[model samples]
Target: MPQSSAQVTAAEISRIAGVTRATVSNWRRRHEDFPAPAGGTDSSPLYDLETVRTWLASRGHASAATPSEELRTMLRLRAQSGGSGTSEGLLLVVLAAASHSAEELTAATRLPDTEVVDRAQRDAESAADAVPATGPVRFDTADAAVLRALYACVRDEGGQAALGVLAERELEDSAASGAYRTPAPLADLLAGLIPGSPSRVLDPACGSGTLLAAAARRGARELCGQDALPVQALRSAVSLTLTEPEASVTVRAADSLRADAFPGLVADAVLCNPPYGVRDWGHDELAYDPRWAYGVPARAESELAWVQHALAHLAPGGYAALLLPPATAGRASGRRVRAELVRSGALRAVIALPAGASVPLHVGLQVWVLQRPEPGGPERKSVLFVDTAADGPAGPPAGFGGTTPPARTRGTARSASVDWPGVTARALGAWRAFMENPDAFEGEPGVAHAVGVVDLLDDVVDLTPARLVRASRAEVDPAELSARVDATRGDLVKAAKSLARAAGHEDWSAAGASAREWRTATASDLSRGGALTLLRTVPDSVRTRAHAAGGEEGRPETRAVITGSDIATGSGPTGEPTGLYDGTAPVIAVGDVLVRAIANEGGPMARVAGEEDAGALPGPHVHLFRPDPARLDAWFLAGFLGAEENIAGASTGSTVLTVSPGRLRVPLLPLEEQRRYGEAFRHVHALRAEARRATALAEETARLLAGGLTGGQLLPSREAAEVRGQGGDSPH
Candidate 1:
């Protein structure tokens, strides 16, 4: 593939030319010598990369793409060849960098483009064993840009970043995102279960090796992993090697359950979070396999199979923690195996987590911490069951399955996030106490319990923590619960008042007939016309700097940074500012408009900076726009930029939809008319803010009241004598 033939989108051209989308549009309309569309639709056409560059150069425009973006663009173009040659080239970069000393590799990167390409080819041939079989690694002048970016990425961000981009592109092509990566909190919590730093750790289905990485952080000297996908195996290998340079890393691309990659190897510890609802996990063929020591897992008992597999590979008395779906604890067909696990003293603990703790966000998952029973080990009498499913606070409102990560940790507010820190504390506390003395362990009321193994040998040996430890109404304190309900009710009353005011301010009516259409211009065009100035924190700069700038490397300090999370919550700059940030980080001013970089549900996409937000620096995942105020209103620009359709139109990326500031379009209305629209949008923002607040308070109030009433703390007000039956309305 020729470098010049690579195609780029209009947005890419805008980025490369250091101009806005509007400027690109203006160029297309005004210049006859502009590059023609090489691909894509008429509305969103792609142009030949070389032709566009020549045009830009002829027009005195400089290339402004960062190294990563340039490499990404080239990779997308290389994919048009329907081959893996470019990927092999990328892999070559990582391997070469890893094989050579940092100074040597840095010296190599400074070589002339022609010599560098040649050196990369030689390095690829030398280190071919490190990467998967991707076609022959070849590099041409066209790939020089990618080669340079890859070296820089490997050096600055580590090999993981370069490999991550390749993995993302491959996943997008395959449309197969295996089980989501294990959440870091959950991974650390699982790793903390192992008493001492085990010498060896293995994850049979390590999606991205998150579990193994966590284990390494806990002092594991050797890490082994296998996955069905080659990309994942490679990623895990590179990531683990980078994570623990001293640990021995061995990753294989295979189906571990069927292929048995390390059949004779026994690990000191095994941590796994296998795929759920897998009906075809080699069930029939593996019926006679020896790993099924507990029992032959039923066809629907894939989780049980993983459980047994983890147990099979563990050394005597070694620990294995598996993240299983909630169903595994109570499934009827898997009852026999469940009983055997308990009877053999292999099952140690079953902790139920709250919903939103991981993927399949609606159903709460369970973590099964087990150990291989040793002949000389102390008698195992009980298994710890900690039901932390409701440990934090309330979850989202009924049926509210929003996909955004929770922005705030307000105790009773509902969001799509689990209180991981809180959950870790409670679960670990119970487990540690139980381990010290299982018999004498005094568990927290309604939260954790140590159950006797003898009591769980029945036909239905259910291990569900919720079933065993749901908060008992009789155990709750009447005075405390009643006081909580009253406090919640008072807050709800205030929220209701605010909601009423917001609701009353707007009596929206429909456009009489057909909806009116308006002429619009891209934000880039507006910027070119001096209507606004667009700015974003330098991509890839903030994360590295944030870590380097941490107060002590554990907690990030972002005292006055306006983060994307803060924007999602619709608050006035509650973000902390890291000491280090992008060199061009913008300090926001009042009336400036801000937009989130990532697309999500349950929140508005854009917000107008307020007085309190005036001097806050924008976070990496945020875009800032300072409007002229004479030509465009901040609210009007934000309103249109955040319109559902406009956002959809401008967003890109496979998993996380990122907003392109230049691509966002707005209506070209007169200043006065824009103000009129801005006023309505302001009211809309107010209405939405109040609605969210009211919903959160209402849900919290209802949950607290329900708990109080069910726990016998509060009596129904005048039951049969209530007004509904006798006066205004029928109870039914």
Candidate 2:
């Protein structure tokens, strides 16, 4: 097939059109102008890109597609040409964009197609020269459109956008399974599990390099990664280079276990979300592999193999965090290895993350934090076990040490709606406490515990955190629990009153005269005029110092980092600041407007930084907009930018929505007029905060009350006694 004749699925058409998939199906059934299928099977047919564009244009739908979507269509066309050259060319374009400023990329992309292609080829060659280890890349006129799209994507959405396009195309081409990405929060959690700042980090199965990126953010200087897929390796390389340009990165395309790319490499920390459940993981071939410091893993215990692989790569006393399936803790075949790991003090902690935290969301995944033991280190006494599954929404399933299952499911287990911040706090707190004093660690009831090594080396070596945490909770003093319940109830009552006041605050009237149309300017336009300055975290690079002070290799001093999750959850910064403070990370200030670079369905997408948020640096996936107070009102900008429609309109991507800060429209109104709206928005924010507090308090009160009653810690009041007397029943 010719490159220009490539076809896209109906789903792709819907994505380009910014509509539901059903809308495209309706177009096909109802409109004769709809493009006919060029190829593919009945259930999943493909359409010619040009034909679809022509049809969409004829119906005035051409303006619906974002630049990224258009570029995706073009890349799909090139990919269907029966060659991988176009993706490589696009990769080159991304590299070039990263090398140059956003303005430079925009200027180059604006040139004639021939000139753009020529420029892309030159830039690609230059990028290859800089990274001499990568194979040579070639670009031609056929790649011109993609080059332009790639430039636009990088400029408008950052390098990750371009990487995402290439990754999607490659994943589609390869038809890879078990290819789910580690959510940023989960990756951060894994990286945080390491006891100290690691100078060098390794992720053996570094899919898309998300974990490596997270590690880098945590001040890891030298990053090593290996993946079985070439595209993934290439993607990780480009992504890391672009985002963490200062970091030294080496990524290889080969199975880490089979090829052992970094055989002699011992890193300060190793983080992996390895592929789960592979019967054929070279068990026979690696029978004598020294990486298995613990008992040899059974063929069915591939997760255990990854556990050991991670451990093997860790420097003595270094930590390794691996995301594994729940069954890995108790699977009979892996009991010997689990017991050995426990007895040897290699396993430090087992954290049960909530379901929906990662892929295969039905099962709550576990993160096993291990330490490569020093030959003469003090005998390890205990391992931290934390169960955050019941700490968030979609609480543990029936008989999983949680309250009785609700009549109706709150949501599908696959939904990404878990309380990540709470989970991180609980797990980290427990781990830290246990690390400080394992023997005397007074664990959080029903949440975390430090289990003795002797207890874990029993007949059935079940290392599940929930099981251990539940047993520990049962040992808590009833009087202490009652006191806690009393305190929580008092707090809940106060919260209810506050919520009522905020909810009743009605300060604004409806706009008259049919919504009052007004002219507007984009955030980019305002930035150009110096009305505001937009800032984001600099990519990790060896040239740049790590965030924390006293970092290895003289890295820069670190500061508190405000993550996107923190903004979404309306919490203070929770992540450790590990990157060098080189002024690239904007220190947030009161009156500044902060917007999440990624859009979510139900939440305020932007916030006016308050006094509490001031002095904190913005982290990755967050946009900081500091307005010239004389020219712009922070609340006004946040009010409009955070609007659901504005966010939806400015976002790109099919699955995860990436916000285009520069393109987000803001109303052009006088400061006085803006203040009125800002005040209203501020009130709304207050109401929301109060409501959230009240809801949390209510849930906590219910849980405590239930626990108190069920555990026989509290008795019914006199009112209940009178009711029993009326029913002619004697009190026991």
Candidate 3:
């Protein structure tokens, strides 16, 4: 390819050269021989990749990259020439070719470029039945590098990995980047929620057929799905067939709500994770949609429309599980539908998941487990409500002991670590129990409760799991509450005292005039100097091993994954290691500095691994910096690397700032000075930790006190000690 034919930005050059983006700009400015802009706007000029690579090689700049990265680069370069339609068409080629054995793929890549293209075109045609064609599939000799890279990616990284890149191109290009696959754990949970093992399953708004595949695992011999995106529909059809070759799979490309693909089909069950909060799901046109058996969903209530659609496709008494945003459970506009579902006994259970469970990771989403009402069957008496979001099992009555991410950190808070297995178990246990005997089911207090439908049918018809489950929290053991309150108060008092001491221990003085300036080195520079090591978990790699014996509990072979949430919240590692990694997860030792991968919020960015954090594996969205204690101080490194200015300078991307490890710079200082600063930062970390713990405890105590008061479990403080200070503040 001509040097000008393939181009990249300064960021891409930085990545290829393993240097900071600033370094690339510096090279462009200072080196007259540096490649000039080959294309793109003046503000964001693109350099020829071949020219840049040659320049970097001549200068002895490091450029040791893996084949996966090479493939990604080739794909990016190709995307510039090939439009999205071509990309979609090419994806079919990938899925088709992915079925070939690694040896077969490797052997094909060694052939002449012309032969490779011909072979790839044959592969695309061969899987026509598995991956239905959305458009014509074609490849030129020019695409040979991409063709070889594609097969290599499938051969090395796995087919799903290659497919993800292609799917991402379309999603990002179309500005639908929020599209994400349902987590496999959540998929299994949804599949397990249905009362019986469904033999014929349907997912109306299937994305990638995750739910349908889950159903397949549960012995569903006939699987059906519909999606609005052709790419997704094609991908799902192939994925479902691959997952269950014996199962009959039918996936059509069409908006299920706007265009009913299976209007007359009935299924044993429906499992869906539909789009949320969409206003134009053909609502005005679908106002009289027969699927609106419950009620005509308001434009804002697209979730209810999906719920009814699932209901419409079900056999009588067949169950449906839909993952919905929390708003859907309590939105006033959907009250009529909620009431109707409750009255007809169609709505069975509403389970709240911990935040970070899936996309829209910032919000704690809910799962609505519903069953179509069978005519002349048993009358529905109550609705089951389970709250996994709160600490009471947890929620406001109790909650996951996770610190709120700093106001600036927007998505995927530490609370995401609330145990997935625990959440699944609790939800499934309550659901199975409820289904077995709805009338006699007495739910676990503070976690789950079965509320009479009459109570739910009240004016609001609000079915938020936390609200319903919270009322039962007051029924939590009074003795347990009293003991917890007293113990937590003591701990809080100790933490308060510690916070005060740490705050008072600071001994540094600010520079008098201009802020102090010092020569600094990027973290990558330090790594080159052997002062630190960077480590990260390949989430995809780690999931393969998730099938091992233990979970996040740290068994003999199991390692707990320390996620960004755990670092931000000062909580124990909550990420369940998906048996995902190949070998061992990056092990954290004391003195290892951890940084959040994204600069989304204002919360603390880094913390030194304490004794409690040792031995745990680093999770996604967490960057690990294990400093050689002899050469660097962990706290000192963490303090400077996590500074707001440093993170801001290092981060890239609009809307979501992703920190670049190679860009994070720290000041060069003597070991003695570093120790002094490290000590102070240590105290600061202690102070912050204590403050977060104290705040959470105080909140919990206040909740307990309020519940106690309202439930008549506690008396007024008539005998309480009075304050001695004269100020009104003391009295208050």
Candidate 4:
């Protein structure tokens, strides 16, 4: 094939066009002008890339692919041209392209094919110098289109986008088992479990470096990661570089348990979400490994091996947080190791997170936080156990009262839906409180508890947080419980009234047109025109100092940080202020529009900062649009920008869609008209908040009433008997 005649499979065409494979098949069958097969078998015909582009353009379907998708197409084409297994080489080129500015990338892609390859090779060499065990980076004429795609992807989307593309392609090709990306929010929660700031961090079995990236966000200056797959290691390196360019990052392609890439190195902290339930994790071969300070992990105890590996890499007094299958905590095979970990004080806390938090979504994963003991530190006494399984964004988890569970995806058993932000807050609040004063730790009833090490050395040695929390809740004071129930009932009544009022607020006439349409401008255009100011969190290193100083020197201090999750959940700012008066952190003001950087189906993605959130700093995962009041209404912008369709259109990525703030469109409207819309939006927000509050209160009330009645703390009133006799419904 000619160097310029890069051919792509029909599936690749579908990806390029952002359409389904069936759609591509339909196009091939129906469109007479569709390009003929350039190569490949009858079942999997390939089409010329340029020809396909031309046809798609004629059909008004050209350039529909996101940067990542485009990059994937080019990588596959390069692999085809390079004979085979050169996708890794293309990945190197992608990384190199990511190192350059958009303008530089554009200029480089315009070079002759051979020069593009040469430039990519040079860039790859420089980029790969930091990664260990990475062989020489090479490229040829086969990589021409890939080089262009890499450049364009890096220029338009981001280095992270390019890395994601490369990782997806590599993982798909390798057929890597048990592969899943850790949700960013979950990763953040894991990172937050570490008590103090960690200077150096390591993720022994880092998968695409999500946990390490979260650690970097917490001001970790040095990042070291080892993944068995070379693609994952390379991806991690590139992602870390893009996320925190100043950090010293070293990612190696090796099984940390088998190869121990950084054998002599210890880090200030470790964060990992290692592959689970691997029976052949070199268990027998490495039975006597030094990393297994707790005990030799059995073949069935692979998670234990990973846990010990993480612990071994942590410095004295440093913490290692691992996300593990709940089986690891109570499996009889791992009981000895679990007992020893507790006895030695290395096991600090075992938090049971809600199901649907990550992959194997049916199982509630447990976060094991361990701290390496100082040579002669005080002997460990207790382990904090937190069960946030029933936690939600507003209050307790929804669907109480034996309600039929929400429909779940096939092949996965129904698991309680997780309120990520609420769970995160609950976990962190308990962990931090315990860390501050372990000896005096007063556990939250039905949520968290501190169990004595002696108490946990039983035969079962199960450290499941739910078990401990259930026991704690069972022992709560009846008087206190009664008071809480009474207070909750009062609150529920008030919330119901508020919801009723909001629901009954003035209604507006619908647009007469069959479909609503309006001229719109991108956030970037509005920002450029000085109609609004956009702000995001600074890098961790700077943020840490600002947080430490309660803001930048001489700047106004913030009381809280409003996160994307808070906006999605209709909650007030949930993040504690870094107290960093750094002016770099945008202080949210009332009337400022806040949009979540991530898009999910759970809730609204945008909200206007209200009095409750005013003076708060915008969190890293939130975008702040401070519109000029004279020109724009905050709620009007929020209403349009937060529309589900708008978010879906502006979002990028395969599973977790990341919103591009600059791409968010807002309809232009006069201030007076905008306020009219804004008022309606405000009422809608109020109604939603009130509804959530009412639901939460109702669930709480039902639980309390059931528990109180069953435990004989309260008896049914005479009115209930009279109502039942009068044919009225009885309170269950």
Output the TM-score of candidate 2.
0.80
lDDT tens digits, residue span 402-443, model 2: 342211112475445566656666677667778877888877
For candidate 1, the per-residue lDDT at 388 reads: 69
lDDT of 1 by residue, 100-127 (tens): 5545656666777677688778877876
Per residue, candidate 4 scores C-alpha lDDT tens digits across 1-732 of 234678888777865665546567888889888899988889888788899898888875575666667776776666657633255565666566655555687898688878877887787776666555566666777677777778887777666667667666667421136457787789989989987789899998887888888888778889999898776787777777666667999888888888988999889998988888788789878977888899998889999998888888888999999999999989999999999999999999998877777877778899999999999898888999988774223233222212212111112333333556667767887788788889998876667789999999999999888788767656667887798789878988998998899888885786786867666776767887899987755433324433445743435454688876577667677676432234656677888888888775466788988899888888867888989999998888999889987776566556556776766778887899999998889888888888777877777787777767765666789987887878957555
- My TM-score estimates for the predictions, one after another, are 0.72, 0.80, 0.73, 0.80
Flag the better candidate by TM-score, 1 or 2.
2
lDDT of each: 0.74, 0.76, 0.74, 0.76
Worst-scoring 10-residue span by lDDT in model 3: 401-410
lDDT of 1: 0.74
For model 3, residues 419-530, the per-residue Cα lDDT tens digits are 4545665777777777878898877666789999888888899999888887886566778768877886787688778777777775678889889888787787788889
Q: 29 in model 4: Cα distance from truth in Å?
A: 16
**Model 4 misses residue 352 by how many Å?**
1.0
Error of 2 at 334 (Å): 1.7
Model 1, 549: alpha-carbon shift in Å?
20
**Clash counts for the predictions, in order:** 7, 16, 26, 10
* Greater-TM-score candidate between 2 and 3: 2
